[model samples]
Target: MRFFRAAYAVAWKDVLLELRRKETFTAMFFFSLLVLLMFNFTLNLDRTQVLSLAPGLLWLAITFTGVLGLGKGFLAERENECMDGLILSPVPRGAIFLG
Candidate 1:
């Protein structure tokens, strides 16, 4: 279908860009690891203390990593002005947005 083709094109474009740059994954990995480590340090790790803090630590890492990764996603689009090109496309805006 035409819609599916366009969607694949956009996804493939992004995949190629990411493959060449490799910055986004590296940043996300390091940022996520740093968040996990920070949570561990602040909790004052110990046998008794560690068990109670597990959920809180995991949740904090997920929240922070998600926020950080989302920010980077926005930045990547902005950095190359890809958003502007997307906005100018003839396709339905919602489809572009969802992509």
Candidate 2:
């Protein structure tokens, strides 16, 4: 329960920060859109070929966007020195990891 609580707190903090800034959200949105558009334009596949490849392309877009978003979040924390505070907190290391 304590671990969950700490994780929740950290998640909530991140949510609030994201809501305020929207930096990660905006970047991920644009990047994913650009990727999709680029794929659509560059692929000369027929309908059947496109259908077969759609799922893989979708996952690729999602994976890249997720990487970008997470990278931005970590960079923000590092820039603000919040990671040090998190490390110094009384929460267990596992809880912090979960967070």
Candidate 3:
């Protein structure tokens, strides 16, 4: 229960910070669109080409956007030194890394 609460609190904190800043989602969305466009332009996304490359394109977009989102996800904690606070909370280091 305590672990669950902590997880929920951390998630809620992230959501609230994102709501206030609004830049993370905006940047991620724009970057994803750019990636999609690049895939189309460079790969020549015709039906046959798209069929073959579609999985790669989709996964590439997801991976890139996930990386973007990951960087942005830490924005609030970095700004407010929340990472230090989290570390002091007794959670295992591996859990923090996974988080």
Candidate 4:
């Protein structure tokens, strides 16, 4: 219970910071949109084919965007020295990850 509480606290802090800046959300949105657009232009699929492929394409964009977003989030924390602060805290590594 304590472990979960700490994890929630950490996650909440991360969420609040993200809400304040909105960079991660915007970047992820644009990146995913760009990816989908690239595919749409390149594939030239008929409407039926595009409909069929929608799920796969969406997942592909989501996968790449998620990877980039995680890296960007880590970089933000590192640049602001927050990563070191988190490291010095008593929080378990898993809790930090959950954040």
lDDT per residue for candidate 2 within 1-99, as digits (tens), equals 999999989989988888888767888899999998899999989999999999999999999999998888888999999989999999988887777
lDDT of 3 by residue, 1-99 (tens): 656666666777777877887778888889999999888888755798788888888899989998888787777578889899889988765555544
TM-score, every prediction: 0.67, 0.91, 0.78, 0.86
User: What TM-score quantifies how close candidate 4 is to the native fold?
Assistant: 0.86
lDDT (CA) for every model shown? 0.75, 0.90, 0.79, 0.89
Across residues 1-99, which tens digit of lDDT does each residue of candidate 1 receive? 666666777777766776776777788778878888877777677888888877787787778777876687778889989989977887666566555
Q: Which candidate is the best by TM-score?
A: 2
Q: Native-vs-model 4 lDDT?
A: 0.89
lDDT of 4 by residue, 1-99 (tens): 777988899889877877887878999999999999999999999999999999999999999999988788778888999978888999888888776
User: After best superposition, candidate 2 residue 84: deviation in angstroms?
Assistant: 0.9
lDDT of 1 at 33: 85
Q: lDDT at 81 for candidate 4?
A: 95
TM for candidate 1 is 0.67
State residue 75's C-alpha deviation in candidate 3, in Å. Answer: 3.8
Q: By summed lDDT, which 10 consecutive residues of candidate 1 come out lowest? A: 90-99
